[model samples]
Every structure is written in structure tokens, then in C-alpha cells.
Target: MTGPFGATSTTDDVLAGVTLTGKRILVTGVSAGLGVETARVLAAHGATVVGAARDLDKAKAATEVVRAQAAQGGSLELVALDLANLASVRACADGLVAAGKSFDLVIANAGVMACPKSFTADGFETQFGTNHLGHFVLVNRIAKLFAPGSRLVNLASSGHRFSDVNLDDPNFEHTAYTEFGAYGRSKTANVLFAVEFDRRHKAGGVRATAVHPGGIQTELGRHMTPEVTQAMIESINVANSAGGAPAFAWKTIPQGAATSVWAGVVAAADAVGGRYCEDCHVAEIVDGEGLRGGVRPYALDAENAKALWAKSEEMVAEAF
Candidate 1:
């Protein structure tokens, strides 16, 4: 469905004519890909952007690139954040909170994709720990830093269609681990986090939304081996064939960042909080294996979201 923007829209297009004077934003994973572009466009529009990355040196370099793109009155800075390590997450969040800074928008855009099985320092499966739980803890602890009308944008994925979250065994303590399965569960958790976070905080004028930035060639896919990549493409084609849906194509990096930039800054997005978005609009809810487009029903379920939140709280209690 068409909206103010379309699938080919870029961050600059979504943000055209919008002035972000005095706006304060935090964008994670600014070292490359959509995060860098997202930060760059926002900064160029006159916002103060804090670009978070695991490597300060890299982020400092990246921030220069973003700074170079900034228009008059725009500014960009770098912060260190390593989502996989709870201590790192705590230090980063604490530093910001201690600085008494408030954010108009916080984009949880950093994440890892399907990779060979591994665990975070906290003993969570790497994908679940880093992609979902890491952001979960960071956001919740810094919830107070969100100004009224602030937005939290979680970068979920259409690959969530790979599987529903298995909360009981989210860490794969019992079930066999598959890379994509873990990735899917984590992405689903991103949406569920938005659903529950929005429900709890919307009345206070804070909102959360999850976005599936259309696929683009980025470092996020560095873990994909040739064989795995081929299998993934084949699987998508097979599913599309079965569902009578056209195959999907990769988007340019700018186009890939469009929906996220829209969700974070568009006034219309208030009406779609707790929903999954793509192509700069709220996506439909669909069931089955087809990858054409749409969020899985389970991703937005209130109960599932609530349960996941509770479990997350337990998991991160000590750190928080």
C-alpha cells in the first residue's frame, strides 16, 4: 500500500523539508550500513546525533563522515556501546544517563544476523543476546531518558518469518540450534518489545515501533557463507512460488533506511506504534512461509509481548 513514501524512498526523501532543530537522537551501530546513513541524514537535517558503536576509533572516524554530511547547525558525536556484553551495555547506558541527557529518539538499529552458533558473555545465544536482549536491557534502563513524545525504533526483520519466538527455549538450552532460527526469534523479540513497550509507555507520550528495513547488501550479512546464502535465496524463492508471490529484490542502502527514518520522525507514525513497518508504512499481518511482505501474527501479540518482557526483566535483573 502506498503512503507519503514508497519502497524506493531514501532517508533524505522521507525527511524532506523537515527541520530537526534542537532534536537529540541516538543511533546504534554507526560504523557502517543503515546506521551510518540513518545518522548522516538525520544530522544533515539539523539534529544533534549521538552515533553509538562498539569501537570508539571506528565510530570517531564514522562520525567524521556523518559530520561532513551535516548541514549548517547540525552536529554529530560518538559513543561506545557493545551490546553483546552486559557490562558494556551498562557502562554505555549509565554514561548517557549520568550525563543527564534526554533523547527525542533512540534507534535500536544495531544487530547481528544469522551466524554459526555462539553465546554472548551473558550466556545467551549470540543472536538473541545481542540483537534483542542487549537492546532490551539498554532501552529499559534508559527509559527515563526518553522525553515526552519520544520514539524508540527497533530494527526488526522480515526474516522473522523464519520462525516464531520460542520463549521457553529462547537460549536453545534444550532445542537444537539453527542460525536462522535464532535470528528469527531475536527479530520477533524486537517487535514484541515494541508492542509491550508501547503499551506500557504510550500514555506518557513515549512510543515504540519496530521496522523491517527492506533487504540491502550490508555487513550484516558477513556471516552468510556461500552455501548458506544460496540456501536462503532458494528457500525464499520456493516459498514465494508456493504462495504465488513475486520474488523480493535487495534495496539500496538509502532505500533500506527509509522506513526507519520515517518511523522515527513522521508524525503519522504515532498512529502505528507497536506495529511492524516496512516501505515507510505499517505492514499487514500475514501467516505462512511466503516472504512477499507482512509481519507474522505472533510478533505483535500483546500477551506474547508481555511474557517476553517479563522474561527479559528476569534475565537482566542483576545488570539493571
Candidate 2:
């Protein structure tokens, strides 16, 4: 069912007539792009927003305008959080817990895209460690901070079409690593993480869902090279033709953020927890080569989710 919104819908559009008084939200990667817009809209609607970033100073400066536009009783604050560093994740979670803040929403919106081979301080692949494992450890450790009916919104991508999780060799220890392959595996992990997280915690009243926020030009693509860009475009065109699908489209920052804001605050989204959502609703599972839209069946595979959860726990060496 198509909702009342579309690709053109902005954060403000989805949040119209919505009052978020008494609600508290934590948005990671809020220093720029969609993250900043998401925080601004939520706070504008009366929600207390905690913006998390690697640089507290930069985050503060980036969000100064959002703070100025905050609704009465709404507020925005910055906290240090580097998803690539487990220590930073732990410290940030601990600080929030100490502050006695119970969150109504948690948006894991921070991520890196196609980049050179690298590893996090934890020695995990940079994309997987920062994008998936980082959020994995954060959510599990701070599980108690979410109030009943709270939503955990993970920002996944249609780029997940590039590959599924390589459980046996996720770090590319023996295999050749292409930039998009590593990035895709990390995104697929995001979807699976939400699936397993919801299965384990929904009984406690919290729900987790993953979202493909659509293709938007953002700083996240700063790492894209000319070769990678051309290859990506060619791949998408081939996929679209093979599947008889339309060409992919990009959204503005606000437009791209619509699904996240919808998933975070919409009751309809809570009802479909654990699902992969796109275009403001639960996405259809599709077959064939159209990497432009629809979710891969593997992304929502229950067994995959469970296995990923186990592996993630082992990697972090900490169980919550």
C-alpha cells in the first residue's frame, strides 16, 4: 500500500500536524546532510533530539541552526560518538545512560560508503565495523534506554543489491575486495541486524526496522571515484533493463530523510517492525536484477539474521 507520501515528500511533510512533545530521539551522524535535516524536523515538532557525532565541536556548530529553529520545549545537544571505535561507542552510551535519558527513537544514520580498504580500531572491516557492528554494539548496550514502543531506525540502502553478508569471510581476508562489495555487505548487515534485534526485543516493547533511504547525493559519496561511478551507473542501467524496471532516481536530503522520520515516529511503522522499509512503507521483496528498488529476500532472511547476531556478538566479545 502506498502511503500518503512519495519521493518528493520532505521531513516536514511527513511530520505535518505531528506533535512530539515529551519524546526524545537520538540521531547519529547528525553533523551533516540527511542527519541534520532529520534532527531539525524532529526537534521542530517538539522532540528533544540528541545529536551524536565523532566531533562534538563540529556537531555543535553544524546543528546550531537546527537548535535555533527548535520548537518550544524542544532542544538539541551534541555528544561524541565515533562508530569506528568501540571505546567511543561505549563511552557515549554510558554518558547517555548516566544522564537518565530514555529515548523514544534511535536513528542509526551514520555510515561510510565505497572507500579504500581500511579497518576500524577494533580491527574489523571499516564499512562493516562502523556501519553495522558499531550500531550493533550501541543498540545492545543501550537496550534498556529505549522506552516501550520505541523505534530503532537503521539506515540501510538499495546498494545492498551489491552483495549479501560474507559470514565466512566478511573482512575479505582471503577474497578480493571491491569498494561496492564491502559497502553492500555492510548495508545487508544493517537489514539483518534490525531483523534479529526486533525478534529478540519486541517482546520487551521495543521494535527495530531497517530502511533504504533512497539514493541521495551526500558527503557519504565523497569516496566515489570516476571508475566506480561509471561502473555503478552501468550496473544500475543493466539491472533496470534486465528487470524491466525504471531508472533509479535520487532524492533531496529532506526527501531522502522522509522514510527515516516516518519509521521513527509513525505508528504504522511500529506495527511492521523487523521489516525492510522503503518509499515510506514496507518494501516488497523482489527478484531479478532491478537493484534500483525493492529488497532482496536474503536481507530479511530469519536464519541469516540469527546467524549475523551470533557472529556480531562474537566479534564484539560482549553480549547484551
Candidate 3:
């Protein structure tokens, strides 16, 4: 089924005429850009939104932006959540549970990109740890607190096209680390996480979705060097000059976040669990569109997803 909106659709467009009165939503990475915009739209629609960020000050700023844009100036709360640390993830989850609150929507929108090689508190590679495993642990820890009909949206990226999980040496213990490779592997993991989560929790009326928010200028690119940015711009320009690259496109923050918000609230997607989505639609199987926008084969493979889930369970066994 087609998504309720398209790549051009904004968060406001997604929430238009929609009412989220009394619903509780938790959006990570809500400090700026699409995350902030999403929180704004949700609050405007009457959802009680908890905007999670690593920086309390940034979260406060983001909440203020939401309030400024809200028609009713609905509930907006801020809390600290750092996906790089297992203890932090536990603390965040524990705090939420301590509040005696259950969430109808949990948007795992926080992520790191092609950062230099580093390790988390658990000694896992930075990208995989922060972008995938942290959220993995978070969702599992809080699975019990999800209200019926709850939706979990994992903010995946088309960058998964660059690579899949390097299961043999996920942390680069025996091999060299490349920034983009680590980012790609983490992105693939994000999709697999959603697939497996949906498989495990869908029976309880909890649905999971992985979304590629499309390209937008956000603080996400802050880590990119000038050379990297230039190369990216050159690639896009080349693609545009050649008719348009299949893997690359430009979107405003609102447009970029449409797919995520759509996945969260669209009734049509209730039955669309465990799939990769883009442009606010369930992506078509990519065959000829390898150069165009569509999910990569490995990222959407059920077996790979299940395997990754098992591997993640082992990697975080201590936490569980």
C-alpha cells in the first residue's frame, strides 16, 4: 500500500487534520531538525510529546520550538538520553518507567553517522553502538511499557546501501575501520532491528517500522569534514547533471521526516510491519532501481534481520 503522504510531505502535512489527543509520544534526537519538527507536529495534533536528547539544554530549546509552533501548545517534556552508553540507556528507560508512563509511539530518531573509529562504554564501535544497538537495548528494555497499538519507528537510512553487518568483526577488532562502512553497517542493523522487533512484538499490537528519512541538511552532517561534504555535493551535482541519482535526493527537514511520521500514525500501515519504507511509502523491491531510491536487498532480508537480532542479544546479554 502507498503511504499516506509523499517525499514532499512535511510533518505538518502528515499531522494535518489528524488528532493525537491524549497519546504519548517519545522522539529521540529531538534537539533539532526533523526530530524537532516531528515533535512540533505531534504536539500540534495534541499528543503528549517527550522529546529526548543527549543535551538537556538542547532538549529545552527543542521543546520551546515545539511550543512556539503548537496551536494548542500541548504537552512537551524533555529528558536526557545518550545512546552511546548502556548505563545511560538503562537510566533513561528506568526514568520513563518510573514516571508510570506508557508510550503509544516511540520514534528512535537519534543516530550517529560516519564518525571516526571509537567505542562505546561497552566497547562496541561507535556507529553500530549508538545508531543501532543502543536503540535495540532501549526498545527491549521498555517493551513492556508500550501501550497497545504502539508504534516504534527506527530512523534508518539509505546509506545501508554501502554495506551490511560485518558479523565476523562488527567492532573492527581484527580488521580496519572505515567511517562510511561503519555507518552503513549500523544503518543495516537499524532495519534488521525493526524487522525482528516487529516479528517479536506485533502479536501484542506493537508494530515496528524502519524508515529512510531522505536527505536533508541537519546537524547530522556536523561530523563530516569539508572534503567529505564537498565529495557528497559533487556526487549529487553529478547525479543531477546526469538526470538525477537513484540513491541521492535533497529534501527539507519536514519532507525528510514525513515517512517517519507517516509510519507512526497512518492506519494503512498497521498491517505493513517489518518492511523498509521511503518517501512515505512501503519501498518497492529494488532491482532496476539500484541507482534510484529503494531498499537494498541485505537490509530487507528477513534471515539477516533475525540473525542480527540473535547476534545483538548475545552482544548485550549482560544488559538483558
Candidate 4:
């Protein structure tokens, strides 16, 4: 069921009148931007949020508002997780499983966008490793922590419009690499992860979905030079204005995080499970060139998703 919301709705707007008094959520990347706002708003609605970040100190400083504004019984705690390092990822997930806390939601929100080519501590491509594989291991390792009716929201991006995953040369080993190409691959993986995860767990009432939070002004673009950023912005605006649509505009952080909140707690489970969403509603499948929005069929392919899952397990040397 689509709701009375659009690209501009903020997290609070989507969550209005909904109380999360006893809900426990695990949100990755609480150190800044959408992550912080998502945690703050959820806590204000009385949900206990366990925030994960690479820099625990930065996360604590940034999440002060989450603590101060929390509704009664709502709280926030910081956990150490460097998504680039598999050892750290496993340790964090293991610790959480040992703690025995059940989570109503897990938002895989932390990611590095379009950074220079680099390898993770585990030797995988950086963007794919951190944004997709890191969360892959962490989430599956703690799979037992998912409460019945739980949800997983993977923060994908419109940048997925750039390209699909290059499983053959994920590290750019034999293929040339462009920053956006790498980013696109990772974002696509985020969607496929949701598709496969939702299929695997929905029977047990645990749903998974992918969301594009809309373009927002945030530190996620730190890697791009000002000129490149401006160029990308202009390109997006050009695309946005097609078909008489409004020119592109950066969403406020709250607005950018809204779809995640909506999918996690507000949308009907059957409506969003295994689907892609944006602007607080399920998105349609898009095709052809000069495209403005919507998901690509390849991203939603069940067989490809399963294949990625198998490849991911083989790469990480762990089975979920």
C-alpha cells in the first residue's frame, strides 16, 4: 500500500503517531547524516537503537541528540564495526548474538561512495566489501537476533543506475574501473541482498527491502571534487527535468531517511518485501535509455540474487 508521502517526507513525518516503545533496532552508520537522523527519530518514538559505526567515539559524539531526545524507554548505544575489516564485522556480529537481544529492524546504512580503488582488509573491493559484503556477514551472523516480524532495510542508491555488479572482476583485477562504476555495482548488490534475504526469511515473517533515500547533501560525497560533484548534480537535474518532472534538488537529511523508516515500520510487509522503494513507496521497473528513475529488471532477478549469495559465501569463506 503506497502512502500519503513523497520524495520530501521526513522521517518524523512517516513515523507520526507510531510508537516504537518496545522495539529494538540495529542501525549501521550512526556517525553522521541520514544515519544519525534515522536513529534520533526512531529513539524519539521510543525505540531502543543500537548504533554501529567504525568510529565509536565519533558515533557517540554524533548521537548525543539520539540520547537527549529519546522517549521514555528509548535509548541508544554505540557498537564498534569497521565494515572494511571482516574480523571486526564478525566480532561485532558475534558479540551481538551473544548478548541475546532480538531486533525488530536492521538498517544497513553505512557505506563508502565512489572512493578511489582500494581493497578491504579481507582483500575484496572496497565499495562492494564495505557496503554489501560487510553487512552481508554481519547481518547473517546475527540472523538469530531477528525477532519475528523483523525487517532489514538496505540503503541502496539511484547511483545504481550506473552499472550492475561485475562478479567476474569485482576488484577491477582484469577490468578497468571508474569510481561510479564501482559504486553502482555495490548499490546493485545491496538490492540483490534484500531480494534474496527477503525470499529466504519472509516465510518466517522477517522481511527485507532496498531503498533509495533520494539524493541528499551529505558527507557521502566527500570523495568527489567540487567540479565533479557539480557536474553530477547538473546531470541528475537534467535527468530529473525529463518528462516534465521537477528539477533535481538535494533532499534534507530527514527527507532522505524517510523511505527507510516507512518501509521498516509503516508499509505493509507484503507490499514491500523483496521490492525496491523510493520516495516512501514501492518503485516500478524501469527500462530504456535516458532514464530518470525506477529499478532495473536485473537488480530484481531471483536467480542472480541467489548466485550472488553463493559467490559472497565463497568469497567470505562462510555460509549463511
Candidate 5:
């Protein structure tokens, strides 16, 4: 469903006049980019935010502005997490559960973009492991802390259109690995994870949705050279032209994070539950080779989401 806001909306735009005095939110990847900005807006509006990062020092340095700008009852706290390693993921989840910390929202926003072929601390491919499996284990383990009316927003991308999850060879053991392809698989998992998680918990008033932040110039591109960045932009423009859509344009950090905040805090729960969102609205589903907008059908398929959930449990040797 379309909303009052669109691509140009900032986090503050969606959150205007909203008070979150008792809202407790957990945001991953708080060290930089959209994560920091998302936390900033939420906390600025009176929510208590717990920011998680792989490196506490980096997060500490990066989030000084968040602390400085927070108002109302807003506050920031940091937690150590390493999404590439299950041991660290479990420890973090266990610590939160042990502390009896409850959350009204959990944003799975940390992820690695296209990077050179590598493996995570686990045997899974780098992107698949760090971006998907890690959050899978961590979120599932800590879900007991999610009270009814809570929400989970996974940071997905339009890149899910690049490829669906290759469930059979999720680790790339039998498939040739390309940076974006693996990233695509992981992003798709982010969306599918939301679908399944929402299905599993929505009856109890918990819902999950995934959002694409749109293109932004951020540290997320640290692995890409200027030439590669240009090439990707050109490719996106070409596809947009084919679809008669507006050419690709980069959004500011605030604009990029608006959809996540909108979906997580402002939008009606039923509109986003178990769906994919972008541009601060529920995204339509599209098919074919086009990548200008909309989500792929398979990413929202109930059967596929269930299958991926089961396979994820098998790969991680844990059940939710």
C-alpha cells in the first residue's frame, strides 16, 4: 500500500510528532551509514536504542553524534557483535537474553556488500554467512525477548533481484562465486527471513518486514573500486531506462534510512507485515528481468520462506 511519504522522505519526516518515550529498539551495524542515522532518529525521538556492532571501539567513535543529538528520553548503548562468527553471535544474544533486556523493535541492518570471495568464521560463503546466517542465529536466539507488538525489519536491497537464495549451494561449494551474486543471495535471505519470521510470530503480535534503502554513497562500498561503482551505476541506469523509470540517483543517509524507520515505527503494522518495503511504502511484487523497482515473487513466497528457514536451521544446527 502506498503511503503519504515517498523516496524523498527523510527519517525525521516520517517520525515527525511521534513520541517514543518507552520504545526500546535494537539496531545492528550502528558503527556507520544508515545504521547510525537510523539510531539517531529513533533515539532523538525518545526511544532507547541499543546499537550493536562488530567493533565496539569503532561504534563508540562513530556514534558520538548520536549521543550528542539525542533528545527527550533518547539514549544510546553499545553491544559487541560479530556477525561473521556464530560463537560471537550466540554470546551476544545470550547476554541480552540473560540481562532480560526486552525490545520493541529489532532492525537487522548490518551487512557486507559485494566483496572478494571469502568464508565467514563459519564455512558459509562470506556474504551468506555474515549477512544472513549470523542474523538468523542471533535474532532467533533472542526472539524470546520480543514482546507482542514488536517488529523486525531486515535490511534488504533491490539487489535481491540479482539472484534468489541458492539454497542447495548456499555456501557456493558447487557454484561459481561472484561478489554481487552472493550478496544477492544473502539479501534475498533477509527478505525471506522476514516473511517466515512474521509468519511464525505475527499471531502473537510480532511481525517482520524487509526494506531496501535505495542507493547511497556510504562505507558499504569500501570493497568496490571507483570503476566498479561507475559500472554498477551505469548498469542500473540502463535497466531503469529500459523500464522507463527514473534514472538511478543516490540518496542521502537520511533518505536511505527513512524506509526502515517508517516501516519499523510509523507505518501501520498490517501494511508491512511479512512483506518487502522500499521508499517508505510497501513495495509491489514484480517479475521478469527488470530491476528498477518492486520485489521478486520468490522472495515473498511462503513455501520458499519456510524451506529457507528449515535449511538455515540445518546449516546452523539450531532450530527456532
Candidate 6:
């Protein structure tokens, strides 16, 4: 309803006084950066968090950090996940199902950005494959385990403004791939995933949201080249100099995680489904800002979201 908790608001700020005792939250990409911060804050607020990472060792390290920061009786555990691989996603979900665990919140936060053109083991474009399809299947597979009143948040990005999904060639089979374009498509898919998921689940008391965590320097950029990173920095500096960047932008990890935490645990968000959020509140439609740092029309289009859902189902039919 209001602007996201201000750019400076940390996860701790948004989660203050929010008690999640006995609540089960599953957070992907929890080995580092905002994911780790999000898990730590949730656990500190009394949630039993299952932190999923691609690497068990990294997950262990992240759990240690969360455990150290946890409130007296809060808890954090780790599970292995690889969003790039369907087999891996299936294994992760199957493991959770086998453990008879259910979740109150599922944060689909793991993502790859601007990496070189690649493919998942199943031969789908790496970005679209990992960032979208994998999460799609994972969420659907675990949907039955999601309790009523549960929330799902996908970590979408302002980068989605660059491009919409190419329904004609989503797998890049017909056209040559570009890094940013693929990244944009993947991000757009993230929002679309939420859009369609809400349409199907809101009536069932399960809600979904997509969030653009304001820019924070995180490992998400590790795949970028030094030159590309420099160019991005210069562009941001120019924008800042020109008064384009938000005054309260460029968050610390804690700050970057605030919006997701708020969306996950706040009672105010109970009825707020299928919206793209930023800061700590629902985001406005971006006409001008969409090109800079907001959700694009195509990304949030309900029709397009449904279409993409159908396409994803076809692509991963066997896996699901």
C-alpha cells in the first residue's frame, strides 16, 4: 500500500515484532547474500527456516550464520538444491516430501544473471531454465505441502524491463542468445510465475508475489565480466548524478532483503497476491520507471502469465 519500507529499511526493520514461531519457511539461494539475510531475519523472528542452497558446504556456513544470529529458540536447517537442473529440483522436493515437511512460506530467490549462453542438463537456456522453469516445477511439486494462508515470493528483478518472454522461441532455438535478453526473459518469467500461481492458488488460500529487491552488490553479478560490471557501475553513477536512481536506493544485504521478508511474514500482505513489490510495499506500474527499475507491463500481464504457465507445463511435463 505504501512505498516499500524505505530503501534503508533492513530485514530486521521489516520483521521487527513479527513472531513466526512454529511457522515453517523455505528459502532458496540461502547460502549467501540477501537469501542468507532473509533466512537469518526470519529465524530471528521465530520461524523454523529451511535454507536451500546449491552447495551443502555453503548451506552449512549460511546456517551457522543464521544460528548465531537466531533468537533463543529459533531454528535454521539446510537442504541441497540446484535450480538449474530438473533432476536436482525434483530430488530436493522429493526429499522434503519424504521428510513429511510442510512450509508456510516459500521464497524462490535463487537466480543467475547475465551469464554466458548455456543450457541446463535438459538443454534449455541456462537463465530461463534455472531461474524460471526449475522454480516453476519445484513450486508446483511442493504446492500440496503449502499450508493455507501460505505465501510464495519470487525474487524477480527490474532487469525484466529489458525484454518479455519470446513465446515463439522461449528456448532460444530460433534466435541467437544475448545475455541481458535472456536474463530479462528469466526475470519476466519470475513475475509471470507469481501471477499465474496466484490465479490458481489464491482461491485456495495460498498467495504468491514477485519482488524486485533494490540493487545491492551481491554475488548475483559474479558471472558478469569485469568490463560489463564497470559499464553497469558507470551507468548507475551517471543515473545517480542525473537524479535518476532513487534517493534511498542501493541497499546493503539486510536492506535488500527487507521487501521479501515483509511480503513473507506481514499480515498486511495476506490479501495482497499476484502483485510485483519493491522496497516494502506493492510496486506501481512502470511506464517510465519500468525501463529503469520497475515491473514491466508484459511481465505482469495476466494473460501472458497464463500462457507462459501453459508453455512451462509442456516444457517440463515429464518432470512435474
Question: Using lDDT as the measure, which candidate wins?
Answer: 5
Q: What is the C-alpha lDDT profile of model 6 across 110-214, one tens digit per residue?
A: 999998998998888999999999999889989899998899999998888778998889888888889989998999999999998998998988999999887
Give each model a TM-score: 0.95, 0.96, 0.92, 0.98, 0.98, 0.93
lDDT of 1 by residue, 203-254 (tens): 9999999999987889999998878777777777787777776776779999
Model 4 residue 200 CA deviation (Å) reads 0.5
| Model 1 spans with C-alpha error above 4 angstroms | 1-3, 241-244, 318-320
Clashes of each: 0, 0, 2, 0, 0, 4
lDDT of each: 0.89, 0.88, 0.84, 0.92, 0.93, 0.84
- Cα lDDT of model 2 by residue, 6-50, tens digit: 667888888888999899999999988889999999999999999
RMSD of 3: 2.5
Clashing pairs in 1: none
Error of 3 at 61 (Å): 1.9
Q: Which stretches of candidate 2 lie over 4 Å from their true place?
A: none
Candidate 6 off by > 4 Å? 1-4, 233-249, 288-290, 318-320
Candidate 4 Cα errors over 4 Å, as ranges: none
Off by over 4 Å in 5: 1-3
Model 4's TM-score against the true structure: 0.98
lDDT of 3 by residue, 213-269 (tens): 987889898889889877866765564456554445579988998888888887364
Q: Return the TM-score for candidate 2, rounded to 2 decimals.
A: 0.96
Clashing pairs in 5: none
**Candidate 1 residue-wise lDDT at 216:** 89
The 10 consecutive residues of candidate 6 with the worst lDDT sum are 286-295
